[model samples]
Target chain A: GAGVSQTPSNKVTEKGKYVELRCDPISGHTALYWYRQSLGQGPEFLIYFQGTGAADDSGLPNDRFFAVRPEGSVSTLKIQRTERGDSAVYLCASSASGTGGMSGGYTFGSGTRLTVV
Target chain B: DQQVKQNSPSLSVQEGRISILNCDYTNSMFDYFLWYKKYPAEGPTFLISISSIKDKNEDGRFTVFLNKSAKHLSLHIVPSQPGDSAVYFCAASALRGGSNYKLTFGKGTLLTVNP
Candidate 1:
């Protein structure tokens, strides 16, 4: 893919329901990341993946918020027992290398607007 | 406590003029800084970045200035265009355990470039 792609641009789920947001990173990007943004706030780090392994999961709010990059190319963010406060945009980004921070910036997907009603 | 802060909620500038957005951080470990622009219903796009080693970096109409002493950074856009109107966010990262991929971001400043 020329750019990062996220599916289900918008999602409206009921409280306590489980939802999954998918992120398809640019081809060959070795690093992937997920962030969440609330109204009036910047994107908050959720998790990060270096290849097929999760290098950092410290940012995940709780066990309810989980993400996986099985093949290192595509990733999924799973939210369990969603709450009203979970309504916001979930963003996915990827970089050429795990150390892409020093080289350049990550290319981001449009994101999935998850609305928990 | 918020490590990064963008005090100004919004900024308005005329096209062809200069637009300046400011950001401040309390964390001293931040060694890399970046700026991103985002439109409604879209994800943020990388704009420019500056390393802690450099005080200033310029690319085309965009310039980033970092003041390590004050823990402050600013983005300047010259000859601003209406198309440049969008929310701008300031982000920072610190090298921890040899990997610095995690980014800490500010609240963001909405810049409206009016014609």
Candidate 2:
């Protein structure tokens, strides 16, 4: 792909339902990251993957949120028993390398706006 | 605790004027800083970045100034245009696992360039 891609630009789900968001990063990008942005707030880190393995998951809000990058090229974010507070724009970014100095920083997707009512 | 802070929630500037957005960080270990601009229905795009080693970095009409002593960084847009109106976010990063990848972002400052 020419750039990072995220599916389901907008999602409206019932509270307590399960939802999944997918991200497809740029070709050959070795580093993938997930972020969540609430109203009036900047994007907050959720998780980062160096390759197929998650290098950092400290930013995940709680056990209800989980992400996996099985092949290192594509990733999925899974939410269980979603709450109304879970509504937000989920962003995905990818870099050629894990270092910003080398990859010139991340290229982000348009993001998936999740709404739980 | 907020590691990065953008005190101003909004800024208004006239076209052809200069627009300055400020940001402050509490983390002293942050060695890299970046600025991103986002429009409605779109994701943030990298605007400019400055390494701690350098006090300033510029690209086109965008210039970023960093004050390591104060843990502050600012983005300046010269001859501001209506198209430049967007939300600007400041991000900082420190080396982790031999890489500077994780970014801490500020709440963001909305810049309105009135034509």
Candidate 3:
């Protein structure tokens, strides 16, 4: 792909429901990241993957949130018992390498707007 | 703790004038700084970036200035245009051992270029 792609551009889910958001990173990109942005706030890091393994998951809010990149390309973010506080834009970004300097910068997707009501 | 801070929530600038957005960071380890512009309902787009080794970097009408002593960085847009009106975010990244390099972003400052 020419750029990073996210699925379900917009999602409206009821509170307590389970939802999954997907990301398809750029072709051959070795590093993938997930972030969440609230209104009036900048994007917050959620998790980062170096190849097929998650290099950093410290940013994940809680155990309710989990992400997986099984093949080192497409990734999925799963939320169990979504709450209203979870309503926000979920962004996915990819870089050619794990080192930010080597990749110039990460290419971001349009993001999935998740609305929990 | 907010490692990166953008004190101004909003800024209004006249078209064709200069627009300056400021950012401050608390971490001295941050070696790279980047600026991103975002519109409503869209993800942020990379604007410009500056490495700590350099004091300044310019691209077209945009220039980024960094002061390592104060851990401060600013983005200046010359001849601001209406299309430049958007939320701008300041991001910092540091190599924290191994290959872990995550970006820390500020709250963001909204710039409105009024025509």
Q: Per-residue lDDT for B1-115 in model 1, tens only?
A: 8999999999999999999999999988889999999999889998999999999999999999999999999999998999999999999888653658888899999999999
TM-score of chain B for predicted candidate 1:
0.97
Best-to-worst order by TM-score is: 1, 2, 3
Q: Pick the candidate with the highest DockQ.
A: 1
For candidate 2, lDDT tens digit of each residue in A32-109?
999999998999999989999999899899999999998888999999999999999999999988884322679999
Q: What is candidate 3's CA lDDT for residue B4?
A: 97
What lDDT is reached at residue B6 by model 1? 99
* Tens-digit lDDT track of model 3 for B1-115: 9999999999999999999999999988788888989988777888888888899999999999999999999999999999999999999888543433588899999999999
Superposed Cα RMSD, model 3: 1.4
Model 3 pairs in collision: none
- Model 1 chain B: weakest 10-residue lDDT segment is B94-103
lDDT at A28 for candidate 1?
Answer: 91
Candidate 2 per-residue C-alpha lDDT over B1-115 given as tens digits, one digit per residue, 9 for 90 to 100: 9999999999999999999999999988888889989999888888888888999998999999999999999999998999999999999888643448888899999999998
Superposition error at B39 for model 2 (Å): 0.7
Per-residue error for B88 in candidate 3, Å, reads 0.6
Of the pair 1 and 2, which is ahead by DockQ? 1
